[model samples]
Target: MVAPGTLLLLGPLLAALPGLGQGQGQGQGRQRRPPPTQSPLEKVAAQEELSLPQLAGKWFLVGMASHCSYLAEHSHQLEATAVTVTVLDGQSLAISTFRKLDGMCWEIRQRYLPAQAHGRFLLKGRGYGSKVDVVVGETDHSSYAILYYQKGRSISVKLYGRTIRVSDAVVDKFEQRVSAVGLSEDMTYYFPTYGFCDSADEFHILDETKP
Candidate 1:
């Protein structure tokens, strides 16, 4: 015949032992669990709200500005003759582009961004001996920018215009955003390959609203 107080203490201890063992088992089980599998850009893409149709079509490399070595030397030197982006059943995207640099031409093809993030379409490709991540997108109705991350190392920013050219104020604002993103301005260069203008020098702004 045990005292009521003694039984109460013993009962609590016995009940706690099973809970302690279960916790330890769970910890060990978690330790043995495999790491999550995800694409290289999955985490980065998850941070933005991107739309689907906005990513379609050929986005020319109108400009490139960067502090990185490869970009500093050859920024804006490469002109994208053609860019073809297609969305597959709203799940994935396929991209192909033809670019010319120093009289040499090459083609790039890639598949990417089954999931959208931020306000851009993200895709990855390989071209000119480097791995490139292509972010073709628009930040506003009047302006857009494409970021090409090369060699998995450096980035090149290309600004675009909805009309013949971007306004000075728009360019200024765009540059500010670029700088805010931690990119250098001195290393930046411009490329005006296609759209409303034929020659690079013709890359001047015109008011499209005036129709």
Candidate 2:
């Protein structure tokens, strides 16, 4: 089990249930609170001059934040995550997200439009009959990167490190970038590494690819 010290749950607070063996006065659980809501923002502008080829390696998800929306829904159950982006022929990009859920391996695949401009691309598939716009705000081409995506009110901010354990300085840098993008610092959550990739072929690539 992941240690409570390492698990960071941002956004809305979970339901406050009573402690497992508490005194009679402490047995009552508090009423659950509702999650916050976020209004839609204006069109998101992309960063300039991103080299897709350089981002084509594996990256681990270290932290994430989002606007007050369902943007983080698909990712909440996921832990120990990694992403691999490969350029296939010309400007077409092959993207993969690898994660583990309760000790089970899960993956998703999506393809981007051929014309990616200023680090902006429309990804047509996101596992489960979904689509999204991907914006890479900043990346060092290695070490760490900040990724953003939104479709309607669902906005996501992802921080990727070369490995699971990055220095606190790196985390601070990512938080700055997140604030620059208009997200609250309290919403940012840090992810832990479990190193759960069973094998090279363990990642389940979505069958949305053309033969």
Candidate 1 per-residue C-alpha lDDT over 20-53 given as tens digits, one digit per residue, 9 for 90 to 100: 3234653453224358665333323221445556
For 109-161, candidate 2 gives per-residue lDDT tens digits of 66876534657767775355366777777777777778787765567788888
Off by over 4 Å in 1: 1-49, 102-105, 115-138, 141-143, 146-156, 162-164, 194-211
Q: Model 1 TM-score?
A: 0.52
Distance from true location, Cα of 55 in model 1, Å? 2.8
Cα-based lDDT at residue 208, candidate 1: 22
Minimum summed lDDT over a 10-residue window in model 1 is located at 202-211
Q: Candidate 1 — which pairs collide?
A: 48-117, 48-118, 49-118, 62-191, 63-191, 65-188
Any runs in candidate 2 off by more than 4 Å, and if so which? 1-47, 68-78, 114-116, 126-129, 198-205, 208-211
Angstrom error at residue 82, model 2: 1.2
Q: Candidate 2: which pairs clash?
A: none
